[model samples]
Target: DVKVTQSSRYLVKRTGEKVFLECVQDMDHENMFWYRQDPGLGLRLIYFSYDVKMKEKGDIPEGYSVSREKKERFSLILESASTNQTSMYLCASSSPTLLSNQPQHFGDGTRLSIL
Candidate 1:
């Protein structure tokens, strides 16, 4: 079975603060992604990494960055947190195969609140 674990289920931070969200996958997947979910916008990809130490910006990458120093771990960093960045953050992992339609396994998500 595949499993993606998020460091936090809920988080609270103040404006202008730096935040780190961590995720770990046990399936040894070749691809990992970070996404923020909002009421109307749905899931917006922030970043994704296909290999260790390699990252690519996704749909919404402003004010956020990602690090994948190790194969099993991926971290999302919010350089300067703001109220508008408050949302549910999700981590997902997928196997890199010829079939691009493979489903990504996701974490339970971290509900973040900025004040």
Candidate 2:
């Protein structure tokens, strides 16, 4: 089974502090993604890495960035945490070839709260 590990199950931060969320996958999958889910907006993509040492900005990448220095790990950095940025952050991993359904398995999610 593919396993994805997230750095935190819950997080609290000030309105302008930086935050780092880490994710690791044991499957050595080539695709990793970061998404922030909100009550009404659903899931919004923040970033993704399709291969080692490669990263791409997703639809909502304004305050986020990603790093994939190794095949099995991906990290997300929030430049500054804001009240509006408080949401459920999910990390997912998928095979390099799986595109149908975008069938990526996810972590339990990190619930972040910015005060």
Candidate 3:
């Protein structure tokens, strides 16, 4: 089974502090993504990497950045934590096959709070 592991299940930080969230996939998937979910906005992709060291910005990249140093690991960085950044962050990985419609495997997610 494809398993995605996130470094933290929950995190709390003070405003202005830099925060790091991590995710690792066991299946050696070629694609990984980071998203943040809010009450009204729903899940919004922040960044994604299709290959090691190759990343693309998603819908919202401001105040956020990502690093994919290894094929199994992806890291999300909150440049400066703020109250508005508090939300549930999700990490997912996917592999493309000859067949269409590959579904992404997701981690349990990290609930972050910026105080």
Candidate 4:
């Protein structure tokens, strides 16, 4: 079974603080994604990497960044956390070679609280 591990299940921070959320997948997936979930906004992709060292910014990329130095690891970074940025962040992994209709397997998610 494929498993995705998130470094923190819950986090709290003050405004203007830098936050780092880490994710690691046991499966050797070719694609990894970071998304922020909020009320009414649904799940908005923040960034994704198709391969090692390759990254693509998603819809809401203004307040977030991502890193993919290895095939099984992806990290999301918030340069300066803000109150509005407080939300549940999800990490997912899927194989690019798989069928396009296939759904991505998501991690448990990290709930970030920005005061």
Deviation in Å, model 3, residue 113 alpha carbon:
0.2
lDDT of model number 1: 0.96
Residue lDDT tens for model 4, 24-84: 9998999899999999989999999889999998999998888889999999999999999
Please state the error at residue 42 of candidate 4 in Å: 1.3
State the lDDT at 106 in candidate 3: 96
Residue-pair clashes per candidate: 0, 0, 0, 0
Give the better candidate number (1 or 2) by TM-score: 1
- Cα lDDT, all candidates: 0.96, 0.90, 0.94, 0.92
After the best TM-score superposition of candidate 4, give how far the Cα of residue 27 lies from its true spot, in angstroms.
Answer: 0.6
Which scores better on TM-score, 1 or 4?
A: 1
What lDDT score is found at residue 58 in candidate 3? Answer: 97
Lowest lDDT 10-residue stretch of candidate 3: 95-104
Q: Worst lDDT window (10 residues) for model 1?
A: 95-104
Scored by Cα lDDT, where does model 2 land?
0.90
lDDT of 3 by residue, 1-78 (tens): 999999999999999999999999999898999999998888999999988999999999999999999999999999
Expressed as tens digits, the lDDT of each residue in 1-115 for candidate 1 is 9999999999999999999999999998999999999998899999999999999999999999999999999999999999999999999999976259999999999999999
CA lDDT for candidate 4: 0.92
**Which candidate wins on TM-score?**
1
